[model samples]
Target: MKPHLTLPIAIATALALAACSAAEPPAPAEPPVATETPATPMPADPMPATPANPSVGGAAMDAGKDIVTNASAAPNLSTLVAAVKAADLVATLQGAGPFTVFAPTDDAFAKLPAGTVDGLLKPEMKADLAGLLTYHVVAGNVDAAALTQQIEVGGGSATLTTVQGAILTAMSDGAGGITLTDGKGGTAKVTTADVRQSNGVVHVIDSVLMPK
Candidate 1:
């Protein structure tokens, strides 16, 4: 009876130990190590660069634009632009040939006699208007530096043949400026020089040049 009782006691103890082992709860699962995601970097602002060309008529001039396109943007050139349109010379001024333009300001156009611009803009006077406007344009891109060099080379004056088939006399104004004498002896001083464009360069003049 005593030996049976001892064996029973041993079996009960073994079962209790097995139950305790099962209740241990997997060592708390190591607390799930938190992996932090890296933060995203922000982008920088995109700023535009400054343009190299100077402003004209209170508007910024872009060197990538052609002559007619640039001239149309200038406030001081509205009269000249209208005259060009009336003369049907927009296509010619916008052409591929590198033209040198002596651009006249609105004040320059105002110096003409009353009704001169209106008269020239008429349909019947298209040929005359075209001829008169072409007098302000030379065949090639003659910048201020080149014109100065030409004047120096020709002993203080240079002759420029216009697209209007007339001769223009370029001379130094004795004060580091250029003066253009038209065929009719009217003189125009270059107020602003070296206004660069895609197709050519322009020198803003205070007076309109005329052909003979």
Candidate 2:
């Protein structure tokens, strides 16, 4: 009797499978996962660059000090220091000038005819020495960049008015340096430049600048 009921039993089993599948609802399609794309990581900011400070007279210059003080600290400028003091121009140079000084080294002073510096340092020659010293100083802060710009604008030579009412000429040395010409037509090369001071800038010259 069991063998005779095989067909009806197979049909009943198939119907039961279909009923179970329909009742389960096919697992609801797994509910699409809301995947959010991760945001790109941002880069960190770069560090600021440091400024360059140049040395003069075998020592670094202090921008916190005035011209007279800074120059007095330089060993190579001893003659210049003495001359400044002898001329009684220390107070003037130390004041709020913003003057550009073409400072000559001791070697530069030596280049003059024998006893020239000694003669200038005499009490009776104080006025003359002051005039000569002032000739090396130009009013206002004239950095190398300013001199370069002026030279470019002035057709390769820039004329600067000095504190002594004399004209000084600045020109490029064709070797990435600067040269200055005084009223006496003497030219001096800037051995060191852009020496910052509280009141102005100092450009160390290899030779003393003489004015007519």
Best by TM-score: 2
Per-candidate local distance difference test: 0.92, 0.91
TM-score quality measure for candidate 2: 0.82
Structure candidate 2, residue pairs in collision: none
Q: Compared with the true structure, what per-residue lDDT tens digits does model 1 show for residues 1-212? A: 57869988999999999999998877655677899999988888778884467778989888888899999999999999999999999998898879999999999999999999999999999999999999899988899999999999999999999899999999999999999999889999999888888889889999989888
- Write candidate 2's Cα lDDT for 1-212 as tens digits: 57979999999999999998888855556778899999999988888864565777778788888998888889999999999999999999999988999999999999999999999999999999999999999989999999999999999999998888889999999999999988889999999888989999999999999888
- TM-scores of the candidates are 0.75, 0.82
Runs in model 1 lying further than 4 Å from the true structure: 1-51
RMSD of 2: 3.8
